[model samples]
Target chain A: MGNFMEWLDRRFPATQVWNDHMAKYWTPKNFNFWYYFGVLSIVILVLQIVTGIFLTMHYKPDVTLAFASVEYIMRDVPWGWLIRYLHAIGASAFFVVIYLHMFRGLIYGSSREPRELVWLIGCVIYVALMAESFMGYLLPWGNMSYWGAQVIISLFDVIPYVGPALSEWIRGDFVVSDATLNRFFAFHVIAVPLILCVLVFLHIVALHKVGSLNPDGIEIKENKDKGGIPLDGIAFHPYYTVKDTVGVVVFFIIYLGVVFYWPEGGGVLLEKDNFTPANSLQTPPDIVPLWYFTPFYSILRASTADFLVVLGSLTAIAAIATPFIKTKRSNKIAAFVGYGVIAICLFIFDAKWWGVVMMAMAIVVMFLLPWLDKSPVKSIRYRSLPFKIAVTIFVLAFISLGYLGMHPVSALSTIQAQTCTVLYFAFFALMPFYTTWGKTKPVPERLT
Target chain B: MSSNEESSNGDSTNENRSRRRFITGLTSAAWAVSAAYAAVPLVLSMTPSARARNAGAPVEFDFSKLQAGQMVKVEWRGMPVVVLRRTPAMMAGLDEVTELLADPDSADSVQPGYAQNPARADANKNEILVMLSVCTHLGCSPVEKLAVGPDPEMGEDSKGGFFCPCHGSKFDLAGRVYKNVPANKNMVIPPYQYLDENVILIGDDEARNA
Candidate 1:
């Protein structure tokens, strides 16, 4: 075995790669419960792909046969229910793990400075994962899946001139039909998964390039011993690998519990409307998307004519205050231009199109987090009181929007969502100011 | 730091360098042309096929059996086109609710030139409304609440038309969109024409215009 390993090492960097990534890789010893999500994300991705492969074996992509085929998988295919449940439950678990993972990064300032590329790649992975989940959701050919695809695809129709044609091209027809289903199946099962794997690989490579940030936000490399190993760091292989195994065991207990007892997650993981076959003629009384997407959906639904005016007024105030703020001359000019453009769009375009824009911007904003945050310190442990308050309000607004999206829209709910939408954008827009406003606690030298 | 370093040996002349660069540019242009050629079929493959397009050909429906204050749905281009025979009360309500509509004149909405009025119905058959059932906001079909009084789904002062279940957008009796809803424009009226007193053709208006 030793001789074989030596021969392989000469041909390829077999042992070298292992040592570089695992055995000799130095990670901070003070990792908390938040760190488990990274490993759990990988585990869920694997579970989804494996279960998806099994589902495709029995699944039909044709619109006519697709709905019945899923029922067949549940009733006839041996242990197919387990595979289906695992895939369905795993989809929600993936989002739960990903959201927590992103939240952990935000709190620890993992996107700061050198780690920006890591965070950017991770954001791309998140977008790709959303596409994957959306396409997968349509594979069941259920009532909710049909209308969900209809509503989402129709959003493209709000674009200026090319909107109608763009949507037609996307749907491969005038409306959601067999062509749409077949193409979505192809993308869901093949194209997106391949992209996701590549993006995840890039995310990890970028992460390892800038080493992992600890809860204390201290760089372990800054204080290496004479032999070139950090005192507060440990080998990732024997230490983190064992620790991640424990996380996996605990994750499975909760994940499989949902699969066995509460796969529907009370009409969240798998919606109750999805049990019936798709009918285009009649829409369900209250059509809601999956839980993970509700926050953005609420943003889309909140953009009325009055909401546009509100947005314009806020932009006008910011533009008026731009000269007084201590920013670069170029930044002031850019802010003026951006505000002017937004004001013009508010006048020219319809509110529905702006809703689509707001929904997309909500996700696209996260990609700019590295630059948005101008805090002197990294972790929440060292962050200002104002920074913590902003984060708290942002999180509450996000949760409120998600809750609103899952229920039927009302006059009161629409007003509430519009208010939350303002708060959501304000958190990102005012981040630099609040982060630099209050006093930060002194960061310790070592990870404690 | 630059491509000049590779040619530091001074073995290559300027003419030789220019010729090499020209070839490289030509090769890149050729590859771009080939890629564009390859991509045409890929993009075309995703658009509506001949079969799907054929399915969208004009639909003819006889609405004689459709009673007043009742609506019938017919499929045109895989979309629900609702044809409603409005009662006299509904027509009177359409005029009264002009203030409540976003586009009462249908100036910014899609319809044939003849049907671009408050009723959103053909000129000869002004009491009969023909509009695409799909909501202007998202594609979900709105449920009809054709009454003129108070009710749920339609607000307390109903003046009822259609109610979009997905986003709560309301429409008047003529499918004129209510103000401040997610839908900005009125519901679309398909390119339709009356073939007879009781029969109509949807999805084509060429003969009527000519």
Candidate 2:
């Protein structure tokens, strides 16, 4: 073993690489429950890819056979039901883990200056994961899958000039037929998964580069001891690896519990409508997207011609109020320009198009969070009360939107969703003001 | 160094640098052009194939078979096409909901010029509506509520139109979208022309003109 290690060290830097990433790598010792989700996300990703690979072995992409093929896997193939359940439920679990992981970042300021690229890469992974799950949802070729693809692909049609042609190109036919199914299968199985693996790899490398942030959001590296080891830091391998194992074991008990007992997740993980074969002539009475996508889906359904008028009036009010805020000259000017541009867009584009834009913007806005926040300190512990109140309202609005998107549309729900959509944007739009507005507690020299 | 010597040395270096820059620029342009050339077939391969295009040819429907206030559905280009023979009462209902429509004139909606009127039907047969059954919102076919009174799917004071169950968008007898629904425009009216007094061909108006 010594001889082999010596030979390998001359050629490959195997030990060095291990020391850099795992064995000797120092991480803060103050990690808590919120830290478990990062490792859980990796666990779910690996579970999805492995189970997904096994599923593609028995799954057929043809529209005629796809639905039956899924049923066959559930009924005929050996242990195939377990694999299918894992993959299906794992998709939703992945989102749950990811959303919590992201919330951890928001509260802890893991996306602050040095870690901005890590957060950006993480946001991209979230988007890619959504695409992967969306395409994977279609491989069953069930009624909900067919119509879901129809609605989502039609979103591309809201573009002005090449909208029709672009959507047709995406479908590879006039409708979501066998051609679309086959292409989506190729993407779900190979193309997107490949991109996801690369992105996850990049996300980890970026995270490691900046070092992990703890709940206190202090840089442990800044207060290193004589040997250059952070005083509060512990070796990641023996410390975090063991701690994360406990999290993984606990996560599996609950995950496998859902898989074995209630894999359908009460029609949110897997919709009841998807059990039937697709028919182009009919649509399900209430077509809700999966639970993970409900918030953005609600945003898409909230926009109307009157909604545009509401948005225009809001923009006008903000534009009128821009002069009263005590800020830099440039920020006030930027506020006016932003409101002016939105007001003009309300005239130039239809509300249907704005619905698509807003749905996409809901995700895109997260990419700007690191810059949008102008707080003097990191971590919610040291942040002001206004910021705390804003975050509370934002989380409440997001949860409400998610719940509302799962049901059929009604007058009350539409009004509720419209209000939530405004609050969702207001969280980011007002971040610069509220983050810098109130009194911040003095950060302690060490983790509490 | 003397000024002349420095100038001569700078001139030779400038000539060599310009030569290298030109070669690099030319190579980059060639690479970009070839990449674009390779992408053309790759991108075009994802469009509708020849077989799909061939299957999308114009379909003829005999509208005379439809009774009053009844509708017939046919497949055109993999989409449902509804040919409805509107009763006089249903035609009059379209006028009642005109004030509540986003585009009562069919002005931002799609149709051939001959079908762009309030009825959204060919001028020769104004009561016969030939529109794509696909909802303008997300392409799900709308459930027909052609009755003249209240409906459970529609409201108590409903004007009797098509209702999309997915997102609650509504359309009148002429296929014009309602004012405050998720769908912004009316259902599309496919380009069609009369073959006979009771038959209409859907999906290829220019071919007959040619």
Candidate 3:
């Protein structure tokens, strides 16, 4: 104990401030990928909140001034563009990291067994983040914001009873107006952040209670000897702290680089049209969200094939509820499904070309996953690098197809657009086959 | 004893070796290239940047530079939306549009004040007709079908107005939409009561109040 005290004095004098918590603290040994991201996510949350606070100091929320004020910040204020870009990119980046982090839980079977509540809280955080970004997107008050809301609100019009009324109720008036803008501004700056912060705290508390999972899918308790030492657990300080610090530093350079430099130049980091004020009269060509949202945006815009639209919407919602999917599942199957998810993710990241090329492929891939595996390990031979790469490229082709399905050009023509849209539908409808048949990839022996 | 004292430190030595190698890699040419590229724009934005100046600067259009029927382009808030004078044929086409438009009077619709007068623009009636090239329906920019006759492919604005090639939405010379076309409103008369002989500032309105 005295030696530990001496070490604390030497290493983390800051530990002295939290004597009660730090005194009992030992490094968690079996901590895994799932653990690292929670910490990273928390750090990023703090970053987003801090940068957001600075941005709000200059942002104007009134309808008449909102667009011009953003421009004022961009043109007049020093580094205002940087602050706005950080918040914008940070919002998108936040979702990317959180999605990856959530996928980590699905990969390691963190969603099941004793940690279900932890997984649930994390899901809650995901939902809250979506709402926060939605509201924040509106605060910019650009044509994209106004029209994107116009289109999305138009979706409620398709609802059976009281649809128009519901849409109007959602907007708080006839159109996306001052009341809506002011209210969205309030929620973006204050309400959502407050809720998001609280949810993050709860997510952490839940994670800490169950400890964290490791890569091997083994429990740390299994390695413990008669001695109290966590056989698998390692001290977080100096060890993982340094490791995570490396990631944080790299991320910091990225964050700072984006914030200090060309903010909204587009094709990356900042959106170009977003630099202009919200003009209702003049619409920017090709309305789309920040890239992180394109997958679902592509899905939502795929077709008027209402059933496929419903299915696509359902699949997107399922992505959030994925944690709940494993509660009753066998572990190996859960992990295999998880891998299927990862394959889909890789395609989403790289699939840039437009048309049926990508969509036709994802359908086949998803359909094969189930039939490929009656059990997890039986699927091992399917994971050979070449086949894996084929499945990846094929699925990537399908995402590209789905993306092109959104707004095909005149040279591309209506038939071309419809064909791509049909293929997107075909992909979702045939999910069971391509996924089940792809390869009998080996799965985990059991879920944790 | 600490692990350092008890062990031969093979793992520690290996870890240190790897960390050094990693740090060494960080100083590679790739990092320099990435940093250079990122810094170029950052440096440019802080200076006399093109995007900065082009975004809100007062755009000058030389009326004399344009031939009576020829169109000249100018930037409005960095958009390539057009502004040009109405030729006599386009001006004559406006009379036919009154009965067909939703708000034929241009009442409380396209613009305010200086635009309230018929033909909705300033003196030198044939000189300037300012309108963004954008279409109100789905936001596609309408291409000018700048001709005189009602040819087959000539849209409803066949007489001469902006025609949205995307959805076939059409607007007249005064930027008024033809009835039942995809565009319901006139092309937004961006807030401008012209500045003087040839210059217009887009960000601030200089139009005379009625």
Q: Model 1 over residues A1-448: C-alpha lDDT tens digits? A: 9999999999999999999999999999999999999999999999999999999999999999999999999999999899999999999999999999999999999999999999999999999999999988998999999999999999988888999999999999989999999999999999999999999999999998889999998898999999999989999999999999999999999999999999999999999999999888778878999999999999999999898888988998998899999989999999988998998888888888899999999999999999999998999999989999999999999999999999988889999999999999999999889989889999999889
- CAPRI tier for the interface of model 2: medium
Candidate 3 stretches with Cα past 4 Å from truth are A1-36, A106-109, A112-117, A265-269, A305-448, B1-210
| Chain B alone vs. reference chain B, TM-score for every model | 0.84, 0.80, 0.64
Model 2 per-residue lDDT at A187: 91
- For every candidate, what share of the true interface contacts is present? 0.79, 0.72, 0.01
Query: What lDDT score belongs to each candidate, Candidate 1 first?
Result: 0.92, 0.90, 0.58
Cα deviation at B83, candidate 3, in Å, is 20
Ordered by lDDT, highest first, the candidates read 1, 2, 3
Off by over 4 Å in 2: B1-22, B60-67, B122-127, B193-200, B204-210
Candidate scoring better on DockQ of 1 and 3: 1
User: lDDT tens digits, residues A282-371, model 2?
Assistant: 778788899999999999989988789889988888888889988899988887888878877888988778999999999999999999
Candidate 1 clash total?
0
Question: For candidate 1, lDDT tens digit of each residue in B1-210?
Answer: 466776664437888778889999999999999999999999899999999988878999999999999998898887888999999888888988899889999998888888888888877889989899999999998989988888777788888799998888999988899999989788898888778778899988887868
